[model samples]
Target: MMLRPFSKSGSFYKGNLHGHSSNSDGKFSVSEVIDAYKKRGYDFTCISDHLWIDNRFCAETVTDASKYNTHNFIAINSAELHTRGKKYDKENLWHLVANGLSKDFKPSNDEENIQDLIKRAKGDGAFISIAHPEWYSLTFDEAIMLKDCHSVEIYNHASTVKCNRGSGIYIADFLLNENVKTLLTSTDDSHSLEEDAYGGWVFVKTKELNEKKILKSLIKGDYYSSTGVVIYEVKLEKRLLKLKFSSSNNIMVSGAGHTNISSHGYNLTNAELDLENFDSPFFRITISNQFGKYAWTNPYWFNELDLD
Candidate 1:
């Protein structure tokens, strides 16, 4: 069953959910990161500095609030959960990206479970996602097993470069799960002043520019993912799911249940294909450059409630 393509009714804000700054291990400051995304045409961004949740109230709260309002920014109030020991000389820790948290919300190194971090985030009305799963093996499995992780970064532009792409860590997860519902996300994890940092984005459809509306749509799987390629449209009305590309480059649309067509590739001159009986409830898209580096859309669900 094929349905009409989804059309954009209003403006959509391109955003990044994972970003770093000097508040953590990143080389830049929070304001500097925001300036970079704004200059690059990104409408919104979240700063999840490692192990340090930037509680706006601690220092210069009034000044920071003023700056945020002036820039028209939607800061999600986020932090990165460090699973590794706190001491610098100790073993490393697993990291989870979190937001909408209180300044007092603290987790011990013994409480390294990703689920616990997610629960805390959600309990406080925060939207939670796993950051840079490809960087560490422990976090990658935790991402797959955790129930409420709204999404995970299949591509982390900065981390991927640092880890040399993590030995196909995430691709194997997709292959193992027969009923996976989480959407794939790409984030720049940008700390430096670079425009094309490989991955660093969340595709969302929301007319209102505030934090509540955008975050709601994002957790509900209302958008796709992209590195550089723009997805002009994606819709599912009948038994068919149609995707439209914003460029004439090569693209591929494949999924778990439709004819078992794994990794189907096609060159795009504005092409469209009918996916029949896509009843698996999980589908994704990929757009790649000639170099095989690409962006992957998180698994779009057909008819399932996200229980996390």
Candidate 2:
């Protein structure tokens, strides 16, 4: 069965899940950060500053969600937890984005390991996302060992801005190939709007725009990640998957066991795939524009539906 987020009809709300402010290492304050995204026509934003004790205690200050919400815009309660490996190195940092955290949630002290931190976050009722595996050079073995991770970052705006190594599609694809059941997400992770902001975001389909609704949609994988492209609809019927999307230079369908199909041309807006002949365990759509920007849909697993 197709997930309710894509199968259900509703308004699409755009928002950035990862971003920083002066509360951590960002250049702007919390209010200014909210305004920056609001003026850019975003419907919601999560002020996920680095979760440290010194400067960024977002959990303490990010109370009163309505204070930052505008007429239609919303501010979600979140934070980015930075966990370091027991053996430090260039790739030792593991950044995890936690959304919809409870008010009493507390960050693990320096003595805690990455697994412990993730467990604590989940216990506090927050959605956990493994952030920028590629940038961290996270191996397939390392990624597959992560526990209770709801999603992985396919694209990270800040990592790209600072260093060109941000995309984590390979890691996500590897996990999916192992039947690890996780969603994909992209985020601006923006430290500076001029350089890193607006380059990544997630489009959530929800009946209404509010903190509870948006968080629920995210947890349910009722969303898609994008840099520029927009998908209007994704429909599955009689073993055929069809997509309606904005213009693109190419559209691709990819899955396990070398299952791949692509259409290349200008102004390509729609495509259809016949799953009757597809033997892959799952499949997903990716669209890329001439400018190299891309949009991605969550994978659809064959075992989840009664294909027989």
Candidate 3:
């Protein structure tokens, strides 16, 4: 069988899984955020504004962009959920992104913790994720604690452009190293209408353009995250992993604790790597385009994939 997104039978929907609007710290309003993404050829965008009961960097309610759903493009209900008790955060908040949330979802009260918030979000069937670990210096202990999350923001656009610290690769690697079994995601996390808006997104392999379908797909890891590069296909045939992607300067296979193999050249379109000799229990692909853009594949586990 095929691996995840490539294995799934569906159309690829281009969407930004994390973003902000004036409902929180973002510069644009909900309607404008939708319009901005739509004008830039996006199939969907989330208004995942900061949701917390505070005056500095959060709103009391999740920003609802559901009204902007057109037949072709759509919006998923989401928020950059926050709670207290984190180390090294200026605001002492733990940022989590909960997608496919209802309008009735409540923000964290003074008494509850991150686990409390995650429990509620999971109870509602929401897709939970750790947000921007690098930006806020999320530690290994904290990541292990948020084990309930489905994913971590492998890339945060605003965090990178603003402070030059937008990577969660270290946190993600730490999780994988611990056998946490989490997926990877990339987000714009756009709080402004500037270069932060279109920098990162996901191509979800969903059957239709419906919000529920998209969110379900995400939970199943039926997607690939990117920052401009594209993965056309990934398939395994007799222990040889084949990848078809956009023109790139490098195609690398990386795994647990620095195990990696790479191919580099000018505008290389595809690669055939032997996995039989690959030693890691899991492996992921990363492609770097000539312009320095990167696309990431969710890590694939060997035993779980049932390679026969």
Candidate 1, which segments miss by more than 4 Å at Cα? Answer: 1-9, 52-67, 84-92, 107-113, 139-141, 166-178, 194-198, 236-240, 257-269, 277-281, 289-295, 304-308
Best by lDDT: 3
Tens digits of per-residue lDDT, candidate 2, 119-202, equal 888877777888878777877777876736989999999888789978988888888888888889999888877898999999
Q: Considering only N, C-alpha and C atoms within 3 Å, which residue pairs clash in candidate 2?
A: none
TM-score of each: 0.77, 0.91, 0.98
The lowest-lDDT stretch of 10 consecutive residues in candidate 3 is 55-64
Off by over 4 Å in 2: 1-4, 53-66, 86-91, 306-308
Q: Residue 239 in candidate 1 has what lDDT?
A: 45
Q: Rank the candidates by lDDT, best first.
A: 3, 2, 1
Once fitted onto the true fold, the runs of candidate 3 whose alpha carbons sit more than 4 angstroms away are none
In terms of lDDT, the poorest run of 10 residues in model 1 is 57-66
lDDT, model 1 = 0.57
lDDT by residue for model 3 over 24-81, one digit each (tens)?
A: 8989889999999999999999889888889687888877788889999999999988
What lDDT score belongs to each candidate, Candidate 1 first? 0.57, 0.80, 0.90
TM-score of 2: 0.91
- Cα error, residue 104 of model 2, in Å, equals 3.0
